[model samples]
Target: MHLPIDLVMKIYYMILAVIGVPVNLVAIVILSRGKCGLSTCTTRYLVAMAAADLLVIITEVILRWINLYYFPVSFLDITPVCSVIAVLKRAATDCSVWFTVTFTFDRFVSICWQKLKTKYCTGRTAAVVLATSCILLSSKNIPHYFVFEPWVIIDNVPWGCATIPAYVTEPGWVGFDWFGTVLTPLLPFAAILLLNTLTVRHILVASRVRKRLRGESKGENGSDPEMESRRKSVILLFTISGSFILLWLVYVVHFLYYSIAGINPDYYKDSISTFAQVGSILQNLSSCTNTFIYGVTQSKFREQLKSAVKYPVSSIIQLIKKKQNN
Candidate 1:
């Protein structure tokens, strides 16, 4: 039997909730509790991104799946609940998308502008940037609250509940869609691409300079520790940014097409839906990859993680041994 698209979507969301939630939680905890000070700009941004991703997984992925699969009939009685879910999903997604750009920009500045980095790229600055983005994005999505409304067309029909946007026919919706897509996804993608390229170029130049310095000095067995840290951060940045671009690029292209082409609405939905589903899953999967990247690229993160895991297990072992001896 062919699996239904709704069922496939349900399974996809279930996987995201299972994997993305716990992984992001681990990343937040590890990044926050590790030796990275509270003021460390990168750690703060990473933690914020993880939190935003968790919000997206819960609201957009898991909640949408539940409404579609399990509670399709009676859930609309509480219309406000549906609207809240839509608002949160949009807000969280907006934050998650832009935060990646924010974090990448922070990395670019820290690497490319060494003089300004010390003054501007501190933990406090990171906090300000994250907070400002959150406020701005959240405020921009406030219109969604009014736009998303729950409707019940018939009695005793279990159609499931969803906050459908009520204003799609309005002339302004096209403008809104354009604005939303650009600000939320496209602009951020472009920023990351440009900033990442500049950052890479700076790193290469700095590397050559370091090599020259080493040659002049004659007998240094190790490299500069600060430069080494910058290199590690750049590698992580690339992995995260590359995954974001790969996962979202197709969806973005499709989104722009739908918004601009004015195609017959009924004509392309079936084909569009398939691509949309795949694109969504790929995008959510990117959220689950960051912690693994951190573990793989950063030796310090792995050591901290090992210690964190080992300490709890060792304590349990000691407790069990004492009980057995007693």
Candidate 2:
């Protein structure tokens, strides 16, 4: 039987939530353990990112699934609960996205401005930055809790979360879109682009310098494993940032176009909505790939993950077998 597109999207979100939650959880566990003894700044930012992604999956994606399937029976239809969930979703998504930028900036400093790393890129500083970011973003999202209300339809109690009717027509909404799409996303996009470009240039020049030094010194440290680690981290960040750009760029462009060009959003509802949905799904899918990227790029993460999972995974399998036999 064929399902409606709406149902298909709900199921897609369900699939994403199921896959993303555990993958990000594993990343949080691995990053928190400091198994690789990498810079604590990197560890803290990565752990924060992983935790934010997990929360988005739980509070946004899975809760959305319940709302779509359960309708009036879902807590999502309640005004307070819906508002809180919406705020949580926005906060978590902002944290997850912006924390990636924070991580990228940290790497940029460690590599490009090696002098500043000693003073600025400490674990304590990272903790402060992360805490400040959370508090700031959460505070910014507080208005959303007040703005979103439950809207009823077809004699149903309430369908979903939406801005109160008055707010939708206000000029503030255009500013909101501009801030959400442009200031929030494009600023970091530009920063990451500029920083990563300079970083790659520095890595290449540094690699050449290293080669010359090795030639002159003959028996010095072989290839500087520290440089190698930094190189691998650069490659990993490139992969992740590239994915974020690809996933979000279309939506950003569309939002900016509509906002700046003074096009009515409802005008393209029929035309661009599918594209928007695809972008949204891709963004959600992005949250699931980071752990796999870590696994591919870092053997230390794999080792810690195996150590973390092996016992409980096997015991659960054995229990399942016992239950099957009984």
Model 1: per-residue lDDT, tens digit, 91-185?
99899988899989888888899899899898899899999999999988887766643345456432324434434445686578678989978
Q: Per-candidate TM vs. native?
A: 0.88, 0.85
lDDT, model 2, position 227: 79
Q: What's the residue-level lDDT of 222 in candidate 2?
A: 62
- The residue pairs that clash in candidate 1, if any, are 39-123, 72-160
lDDT, residue 95, candidate 1: 91
**Reference-based lDDT, residue 200, model 2:** 91
